[model samples]
Target chain A: MTETTLLTFLQWIDLVGVLFNAVLGAVIGRAARLDVVGLVVLAIMSGLGGGMIRDVMLQSGPPIAITDWRYITAALLGALIVMIVRVEGRLWDRIYPPIDALALGTWAAAGSLKTLEAGFGVLPALMLGTITAVGGGFVRDMVLRRIPGVLGGNTLYATAALAASLVAVGSWYLHVPTIGSIAATAVGAALVLLARWRRLSLPVG
Target chain B: MTETTLLTFLQWIDLVGVLFNAVLGAVIGRAARLDVVGLVVLAIMSGLGGGMIRDVMLQSGPPIAITDWRYITAALLGALIVMIVRVEGRLWDRIYPPIDALALGTWAAAGSLKTLEAGFGVLPALMLGTITAVGGGFVRDMVLRRIPGVLGGNTLYATAALAASLVAVGSWYLHVPTIGSIAATAVGAALVLLARWRRLSLPVG
Candidate 1:
């Protein structure tokens, strides 16, 4: 298939992932008691903040939103859905781990794809993929005046995404087919599950 | 005075301003129920976010901490002082406005100084100054899962910094004396004061 076709396919998947994270962000915002404007702001940040950072690093302007209206639309849809459901009570915290897992994997994939399309080398691609997966949430935490979840040893959270990004880089490097990258993502997800269930961690230096 | 003297003088003032703001950030963090780690994180975010973003936009890496430790030192000192002061209880919300003003003015000055040192043109220099002032807060807001105060309809918060930056830029373009930048910073502060008092706003497009 043409690079364009592959690129377009990747973009579509990223769209889904962004919206999923945005919804989760909105839920978190509501739990925090932020108003509507705050909700949209957080949703947008979750959906696009990392990509924006990545694009800026790559010297691209406007990043996610400038590319298309699709990202914004997806974030809006997800946020609306989350709010309309009016999920209440304390169980919402439990839902976080799962949503986080989904966002990490998909965003890693999107980051790798975009970086490659932008003609970056494998190293930059992998690095950016890690940033894309974790950067948004990290920014979200910092904005809320909290320590970044990744840095604070939240379930080997950043490592899971980093594993996926590295695998994607390796997959592309070896000229492997789509399944190689898929397998890599699965490996990442499996690690997250193991880490969460077992409460695992790498010793802090 | 020599260029080094001027630069050193500016850095000293900038350091003083950032240090106090960092303290303010920590105070707020503690008030918001964050632990030690959270307080440090917020202090750093409030102190360095703008300059870091500016560096990233200009493709500079690691920023202040990556090279000199002055910024970090200031941040730590700020946190330490705040912890010592134990500022809390009533009227905590009132602190935001004043702290915001101080940060805005300081960053505007720093941006202008850095831009002129780099020999950028008037427009970019002014913009860089403004960015230096508010970019950190914007990043902090995004991380905290909220809209940046700058992007919101807040009381011309960023605009005052922008005005200062523009004055610095224009003064340089017109070949004014070094003290012109000081005047520019004052102008920016005055604008912020006017806005806070009169609740001025540029109509949203």
Candidate 2:
């Protein structure tokens, strides 16, 4: 696919990721027994916080989450979905992992790619990418007065994002950013799934 | 003062706020028995987080914290001070309230003024201003797995910031933003000090 086509595809994935994360955030809010305002706040924060942070750091203009209407709409729709439907039990358990993994992978890929395009260095790209993948959940956890799971959990979420970022950055250097984005997403999703399946936890100091 | 002079003065106060908050953050880290890295992280987050959030939301240039060397330097200097001195006891107690009050006032004034200058509406200015005043401590508290003191407790921090923001915005409308900035700062500082002195706490819903 051409670069523009690749960007368009990624944009769609980004919206999907936003929707899924927003739903998850609202679900968390439900679990916490928050009011409607709290639920919506958590949904928006979880859906858009990471990308907003990345865009702000990149200094590349306003975050698309704010500039584009669709991002917020998607997030709100996710909140609406959770508010109306009782998404729980065995069916939710069956779908949650893949949805979360896809969100992580797509978000990481998009973040790293955007960083590279904005003329940032490899270190920043990696940092921003990992932040983009995990930042929403981190902020959500914090707002709930919980220690961010990403900081100390045995989960490989952050590590997987880092690896995906490396792959994307490597692809950029090879002059095949399009392929790199696709490959990075796949690698990130695969790794997260593998980690979850094996209960792979990083050793803590 | 002329507009430029007013800006320069606020810039100085802004740095002072960064220094004070960074020290406070490190103090909290020390209280938590955090390592050096944790201290530094908390210091930077508390020092710069609020303004960064405001600037990013404004969608203006890069955060002054990142573009200006003095901001980071001031924050690090705060960490250095905390690491070198055991800043607890009667002397620290006598000093902390005034220092914290000053930081909150200056930050709210700066944030509100900047928001108006950016051509945003009054509500955004107020919201951003409050975030500027209280966001650092909120983030720090979250990182420490504690509920933000601003959200509960009888403290009038957020309310004081709102008043400061209102003053600043009011001044802008009168074409006296310089006076507005100064007045806003004074109002914010005084309110915070009064709250602390009276042990005033807002009622939680």
Highest DockQ scorer: 2
Candidate 1, A125-181: lDDT as tens digits: 765687788777777776677657765456776677778887777777677626545
**Ten consecutive residues with minimal summed lDDT in candidate 1 chain A?**
A176-185
TM-scores for every predicted model? 0.54, 0.61
Compared with the true structure, what per-residue lDDT tens digits does model 2 show for residues B1-205? 5789888998788898899899999999878766554566578789998998898788787777756668878887898889888878999899878878878988998898889899999999999999999999988887998878889884699999999989988998999888888899899999999998899988768
Off by over 4 Å in 1: A1-12, A88-99, B1-52, B55-119, B122-205
Candidate 2 regions with alpha-carbon error over 4 angstroms: A1-52, A59-137, A140-145, A149-205, B1-3, B33-37, B203-205
Q: What is every candidate's C-alpha DockQ against the true complex, given to 2 decimals?
A: 0.08, 0.16
Best by TM-score: 2
